[model samples]
Target: MVKVEIVEEKDQQSSANSPYASTSSSRHSSQESISSISSELSAEETLYDRINALVDIVPPATRHRISTKVSKAVSFVKTGGKIMGNIVWIVTTSALLVGLPLALSLEDEAKIVAQEREMMAQQQGAQQMLSPGSAYPPPPGSNQTPQKGIVPPGF
Candidate 1:
């Protein structure tokens, strides 16, 4: 009975290890690489499998085209210098376009500031010249003249 039990266990282990124990698995290659990659994918799949499938598609045409474009771009950059001459030209032109107006406006601003200072100084001078006795001088015979004919308070 013990010998029979040992034989049964060994059979079950071999059955489990086949990988093609289920019907879904296909192609049993004897090469070491193919044998090593026996476990291709699983039945209960994930998002990673879907994404990997998308990247694994290698059409011969797209690969060649992509590599050619990359090599062409590399060669062009190696021949040409880092900075494009047109960019420097455009930058200088734009600086002059924008800076000229600002430079001209600064001169006008100085003139306007000087005119404002002169007007304020004139106003201050006029205020200084005003009499301390009266902002508006009274007409001739105003109230409370303190004359000889007038009666004094409490008199």
Candidate 2:
């Protein structure tokens, strides 16, 4: 029983030191500090207002020069973009115009090649058929008199 009591006391002490321990005063102080910091920041001038204040310190002539430079830069960017777009359009149109005819010509050439190959094959077959060795020899007793202008079997 005594040991159990001592363990309970130790558990309480350990929990008090742990982060999960909720102390109302500490939470209130943290919330107060956050609110104070937020309020202080809100009281400061906005970024745009600060920039305008800084710009006010510059001489009028210098400000005018800076504005002109900025405007020129913007216009240059716009003009470059337009020029690039036009170039892309021209190149695309040229490719389409040139590629169509080239593709058609290539197709025609391929067809011509195929036809030539077929003709060559047919000529080879005909030559094989006309070759004397391709025919069977005449039967043993079927000899006929040879006539003038007639080609002989071996010829």
What TM-score would every model get versus the actual structure? Answer: 0.31, 0.49
Report the lDDT tens digits of candidate 1 across residue range 85-129: 667878988889998888899999999999999999999757643
Clashes of 1: 0
Worst 10 residues of 2 by lDDT: 1-10
What is the C-alpha lDDT profile of model 2 across 62-94, one tens digit per residue? 999999999999999999999999999999998
TM for candidate 1 is 0.31
Choose the strongest candidate by lDDT: 2
Candidate 1 C-alpha error for residue 56, in Å: 47
Give the Cα error of residue 38 in candidate 2, in Å.
12
- Candidate 1 segments whose C-alpha is farther than 4 A from its true place: 1-83, 133-155
Residue 2 error, candidate 2, Å: 99
